[model samples]
Target: MTKLIGYARVSTKAQDADRQIQDLLAAGVRRDDLYTDHGLSGALAKRPALDKALTALHPGDTLVITTLDRLGRSTQKMLELAEELRDRNIGLRVLNLGGGDVDTKTPMGAMVFTVMAALAQMELEIKRERINDSVTKRRATGGDLGGRRPTFTESQIRTASKLIKAGEPATQVAKDMGMSHATLYRRIKKLP
Candidate 1:
């Protein structure tokens, strides 16, 4: 028998997946067939529960989500996932897609999905352009980009190199210099 599986996600621990799960259950998805990734962003490419659900899908099964964003944070990713499902003979159903819901098993659903994908891609591109422009402007004005401070001083690096050249163990050298062994070894590699 064909099964209807649901996937739900929340980006933070403060958010709840109960609302999405309720909607999925109301749509007739079995509780056992539902997968959830809590405290994980949709933007992340690696989601363990989501992967498990996709792997469990069989041909002719339907994958349901409360919203398209629950499937993916970006349109490109959602479209890629949709194409994968279609190629596998699986159906995708989203509860809140514009004026009506989307079921990729139908012709109208396919068209609507394509249009939405295109619009989302355009929106992302525009956002990228705006961010790039803002960054460029800030750089031109000599604003700090914000990053971590250097872990080792020049004198400390030089001492580390000398210690390493003198056959001192990296761990010992790092302990003597009050730094990490890995940091000491990395500084040694940069010695000319």
Candidate 2:
């Protein structure tokens, strides 16, 4: 019998997959039929759970995702995957599609997916351009490249290092400097 297998992913451990899992379950996918890869970016080619889910698929089965983006960030990769699924006689269902979910078991769904991929590719290109422009603007203004500014200045770090070398505890020095001991050591390690 054909089955609906769900795949879920999160780019970081800080993010939760509960929402996707719930959506898949609500779509009638069994809990045992769901596979997930946590703390894994869609850009990565090798995801253990994704691999297993693909392997579990067979002819007449449908691979379901909460959204198309869960398949991957690359339009080309997503298209290639759909092609492979098509070749194997397996269908694809994206639950959170724009108007309605796209299930590639139908010709109209296949066509809609092609258009969606083209739009996704364009969006990716636009995002890249925006990032490049932002970096260029920041560089032109000599602004530090987008990261949190160091809480401890170079001078504070230098003094904290000296204090540690002069028999003071690292924890005490860090506490006095209003930062964590690990932060203090990380800064000291970066010092020349």
Candidate 3:
């Protein structure tokens, strides 16, 4: 039997999934067929409820979500999931996409999703190129593309370096300086 399964997610504990649930129910999904992930950020790759929902879906089943972001905020991840769903013969419907119908089961709907995904991927690539160029230009002009400030002061860094040079273990030096061993190595790499 082809079932209409719904998946909902909220980014934080304070947020509610009721609205999404209501929307899914209104779209003819059975209450028992609804899956929810609470207090889970869309940026996280692992989602237990979403996994269960996907596993429960069989070929010809429809997967529904209130919004595209509820499914995933990352364009690449969303596109990958869409391709997986397509390959598995599961349909997708987003109730709030473009404030209108966005169902992948129909030919027009599939075309719209394909176009949107392509545009999103292109936009991300362009943004990445701009950032890389800006960083390069800034470095050439001695402008600091500042990152997280060093947790250790100059005196501490000097002490740690001396200890490392004296054959003390990196892990021990980092522990003494209240930083991770990886951080100690990264700091050494930055030294002229």
Candidate 4:
């Protein structure tokens, strides 16, 4: 008989994996066939449960997952896993992709997986570009781009400078002003 393996993952302990487990069980996977990784980031390559699931897969087995994102957030990583499964002659099924079998070897299924991976990669790149643009705009403004804003007013800067000139250490000055040492250093760096 052909075996079916299920993989489930949640990035944080606060997120529940019970629903995924239940779904896999309802899909006819035995408890022993289900591998779970909780409180583990998808970016991690050394996940124990995922490693076990991959090792347990054989040429004729079917690998099932709740969603693509549960397997990995990165398009490259997802594609890598899919390719690995294909190399092993293992079948891949995702619950979100509909209840039926999805044969990656078929032309239509291959096209769909390729398009999904490309979209995921594009989304990540767009997000990174937007963040860079935001940072550039903030730097163009006279804002404190790299450090904490000064809690001390202009009067406080004048006082802190006076204290420093009077031979007080920045640490002591910050302690007296109820600010952190790093904040004091940043304030001093901004000073003329």
The model with the greatest TM-score is 2
Tell me how many residue pairs clash in candidate 4: 0
lDDT of 1 by residue, 1-192 (tens): 999999999999999999999999999999999999999977899999999999989999999988777777677788889999999999998887796678999988877887877776677679989989988998999987667887777787887788777998878889987888987777777766
TM per candidate comes to 0.64, 0.82, 0.61, 0.63
Q: Regarding lDDT, does 1 or 3 come out ahead?
A: 1
Candidate 3 lDDT by residue in tens digits, 35-57: 99999987789999999999989
lDDT of residue 189 for candidate 3: 72
> Which regions in candidate 4 have their CA more than 4 angstroms from the true location?
98-101, 128-192
In candidate 1, residue 22 scores what lDDT?
97
Q: Candidate 4 at residue 131, lDDT?
A: 84
In candidate 2, list every pair of residues with a backbone clash.
Answer: none
The CA-based lDDT of model 4 is what? Answer: 0.81
Model 3 spans with C-alpha error above 4 angstroms:
117-192
lDDT of 2 by residue, 1-192 (tens): 999999999999999999999999999999999999999988888899999999999999999998887888888898999999999999999898896899998999998887787787788789999999999999999977868777767998999999999999999989988888998899899998
TM-score of candidate 4 on Cα atoms, chains taken together: 0.63
Best by lDDT: 2
What's the distance in Å from true for residue 3, model 1?
A: 0.7
Query: Candidate 4 on 95-165: residue-level lDDT in tens?
Result: 76544545565767766776776776787789889989988899899655676554678778778878888
Minimal lDDT window, size 10, model 3? 115-124
